[model samples]
Target: MASSVLQIVSPIKGAPKPIGPTNKKPMRPSNQLPQSLLDAARAIEKVPFHAEKHVTFQPPSRVYTMKEIGLEGCGISPIATSEPFQLFSQEAVQQCRAEIFSEPVLDKYQFSSTFTKNMIRGISAEDAPFVHALWKSPQVANAVSKVAGIELVPAFDYEIAHVNVLVNKDGEGEKAEDNVGFSWHYDSFPFVCVTMLSDCAGMTGGETALRTGDGEVRKVRGPTMGTAVILQGRYIEHAALKALGGQERTTMITPFRPKNPLIKDETVLTTCVAISDNSRLFYDYCLYRAELLQERMRLQAQWLREQKEAGAPFDTASVKKFIEEQREFLDTTLEQFI
Candidate 1:
């Protein structure tokens, strides 16, 4: 993937560029949440995550390819988006919801941003044990990787089970033009698994609108409760459409990057800085990048040693290319520190 392709485009018009940590104070949702929402949260039973019981992986009904979406030769993978597919069991969803709505999580992790009013992020393993273990489970990763057409891992610990919450007071749905939960923009991470945490029994128009390569719009059905949709979000310009007839719509978004250390990482902090605790975000980002660099260097050195032991002449061009790639990687990392 070229650096140009990964450039961050602001989702909202006139959005200010991220300086450092803009969210100095704890920002809460503007409106008071409905009592029903809180009551429902308190009703769910909490349980430790057990993959065998929680994961009910099923292949998606349909997967759109980059070519089909007129975006061939773009993105890190050939697959573009997937139709809603069964991912978690109903019990699993309830457990996740309980964790997300717990008092501790709400008090500490709630984040509000210009892009979305209410979000719950930066939940650590200690804060939400079930949620953290769910994303880290091999079963979940394997299912997502199968749909993604590439091996992937969670982007980082801080991003696991990032929640987006929306509550519509009026029974009516917003007009199409006004239904966007997230405005049009590419994701900072290479891929994302969007799982619905709220029921969508009577919901309508909660689809993902994707912009095709030639500028046409395509809508994919959103996942229902306990289901998920896999998307190459970093390469696709898309937005989340609000669902009608549902009082609450909550979704978990877990970002992913290719598991291979050598794969190009286009992760950026543009979209996260404004909504995140800057200290934690920078630490997680830097640590992961450094680890990737360490592994890459080890691999390169091993290859060089093998070549020399085999009596092969020094491949100056190959060595120089590796050095240049690492230099660019380091440069990209440095740019995110601001």
Candidate 2:
């Protein structure tokens, strides 16, 4: 439960396979909007928008600051070049982008339509060098540290590099519309920093749009290569503009937050999504209990086999206990996901 114990297991190997709605059922087009999502988006429209710009291409980069952009306390910084930025190099990031697009994107919910594969590999803040470098930079660190009021530690922080590779050529036809663009939603974190790593080519329509409380829509052209944008992640309602000109929009979305040290009922991954509500703790606790139960069952099974091989009485009660724990843990975890 402690942060030290939850250090993310080494980054998972092999890119995650695309996820989609698994049910084979077909979906009907409905014009009606979900009132919940609509309301959430509308709530974002009530905040004011402030834009900040910084033109720098070198280390110790300067961060432009702004006050309130939405009720969530969002802000933006337009910087020239994030060269030697705290994170990955231009070339290294380009390679990551290339690899992300090399494969197909899939829907995570396994619903009727597909969701593009935007991945967050397990990068332990403790061991992540690029992240460490970035956090160490006076420019990047000072900004966040000022807000957090504590000197941030790399290993204890929660950070991930998000790579979104959009299709510019429009290959999937109708299905491409599913990928048109996501609706307005806030992240689980309180704030986020976005930086463009490469030039968006062959696309015309993809824009980063934000709405102020007065219903004014401000479109921030995502970063040009090496440019950075920062905003409050939990309060601002924003979405990617539909990609235009047949080119895929590519960008890096990174979020920073303090690490939760307690062993909760949810996995670290789910925590990132549930941090805003703070309800993720319950889910994490359930998940941890479930996994522990599973391991217990596996060990019990192995013990029973060993007893039988030795011609000793197998502990049938132990195996029964395993089955009971597995069922209980699963039942609890499923409820949270639902």
Candidate 3:
């Protein structure tokens, strides 16, 4: 089979360089990888992952609690455990995580990297084969499609799916309980996929916590080795359990949303695009616009809430200001992206 060719386009200079605390190397194209590695990625994309396993569906036990956790979808085990995982070892996995999370987004958002300083920055999907392998994996893509109920597309808006590593730089912090956890909020997309990368010795805590919008919470210990989870993105709330012992908690996040040119409320479609596909360049251009739009809407909503609270006239001028600012930001940002 011909190798998949992803023509990467960027907003600024040349291709995005590999970013991290220290690494300044520019990323090489996929052509640089060994042929066997490329073949493995392609092969995984053509077959069914988790074929031996049944889809595990979780129906809500209660119905009245719609205000809090308002989602409806089936939960399934992760898709790409069998083949791709066989290629990585613990040491190799950690190295991959270190390199990938060096991207700016994950490094800033992940708390463990914030407090202890194990984070890197400027990571792009273009730079990492492990990430690309998962993105191109048929097992993962198909699983996302089945759960999302639509044909998912590869995203190009951003590096949408990624991994997080919370390992100790030295052996002293290798226990599970020492990792930082995230706050409870549904992600921005319609579907979410998480795979546990490290589970054996010194890794503890870091259980997956699920919740409804109504505040019901359930905790499940993550799968060892190749175990994974896929869930509805909008309706359920989730957080990583606080790491307790001395180990670090590491996992990969793969989120899918509608293809670029998204219509509002289109998340109703389960399988969309993975958000970093090359086709999504235009779509990603729109994301900044959408974010600006959302910021304006939020300001309007807040103004209305305040007006009601204070028994005052609605703040029309404030709303107008927000719109103007949003427009300016969108215009400037779109020029850069396009």
Candidate 4:
């Protein structure tokens, strides 16, 4: 389909909620994964990665020459108390945390347990101004752009701030979750900037670890508040370290990519998928089409009822014809695939 005709809604945040008949009967379990999901896994495995022996973090408030971190190196920058760092103040972080507390986190079933690791997407519309102001700073923008070899991507490029929270203070009762931290994965963006509003101080684990192309692993520590860490999203394999004890690890995870005029970068998922591989495109469109079909059926049924109540001409034949056409297409396509 043409890009203009198909309005892409992200499956990341607002996912497909199919409303149809349910089969109450219990079915046998299968060990194998779906072919489409397998295809997704395969694509993930094929992603190219490049890295070095060590990683570092600098002050994000100052503009670094290309000689220091190179035009495309991955590293971190601690929030400085001077000029540029003052842009990200204590009041800003507190306000963001407030919004985090207010917004509802996605449950295990709603999002992928493997990638998200039960982390809450803590940013909300209420925190947008602070987020926009902090991210749009020249120091923050230039530092990331140089390391990423790309021009600075504005906060408005992808409106929704991508953040994941890791809180282990509730106790080990939640230990059954294999890893409370995120699993290893690479993003689709050119670069992903991370900074801690709060750190995992005194915590056993919960470090943000990244692996290089030479098989070298580097563990980064965001020990203090306002520390910024930049990663080569599409190049390195990275994961959050699991928190062993009761500690709070709060960080802002923002992705940067070239802006798109067509696809709306409203939601985190839509923003990522819009610039990502076609595999995600297929997955999202499949779910979106199903949702659209369900809505079409509902609206048609409602129209028929209204026509009958008003004593207007009820075109039962047209409705049946539409149903037959959609059903035939869906059945044939599904049968061929299954």
lDDT of each: 0.83, 0.41, 0.42, 0.43
Instruction: Flag the better candidate by lDDT, 1 or 4.
Output: 1
Q: How close is candidate 1 to the true structure, as a TM-score?
A: 0.91
Order of quality (TM-score): 1, 4, 3, 2
Summarize candidate 3's per-residue lDDT along 1-338 as a digit string, tens digits.
Answer: 22221111111211111111122221222212234322432343222223223222232222122222332222221121111122233443443444444434333323322112232222355555445555556655665555444555444324444545454434544443534365555444445556555555655666657664355775655544544555444445566665544344556666664332222222311112222232443456466457635654664566567667777665566556555655654564454332
Ten-residue region with minimum lDDT total, candidate 4: 45-54
The number of the candidate with the highest lDDT is: 1
State the lDDT of candidate 4 residue by residue for 1-338, as single tens digits: 11111222221222111121122221222222234322432342111111111112244444332123222233222110111222244445554444433323222101122244323332333334445445655555665565544454643323334555554546762564664366566554435677666634566765666564355666655334555555544435567777665445566766664333112222123223322232433454355446546665675666667667777665657667666656753663353222
Clashes of each: 0, 36, 32, 4
lDDT of 2 by residue, 1-338 (tens): 11111111111121112122332332322222234322432343111111112223333344322233333222222121111233334454443343322212111111122333333233333334443344345555455444333332222233445545444334543346443375565554435566665555555555666655466766655555655555543444567666655434556665653332211112223223322222433443444455555555565556666667777665566556555645644674565454
Looking at candidate 1, the ten consecutive residues that score lowest on lDDT are 1-10
RMSD values for the candidates in order, in angstroms, are 5.6, 16.8, 15.3, 18.1
Q: Would you list the clashing residue pairs of candidate 1?
A: none
- lDDT of prediction 1: 0.83
- State which candidate, 3 or 4, has the greater lDDT: 4
**Model 3 lDDT, residue 91, Cα:** 41
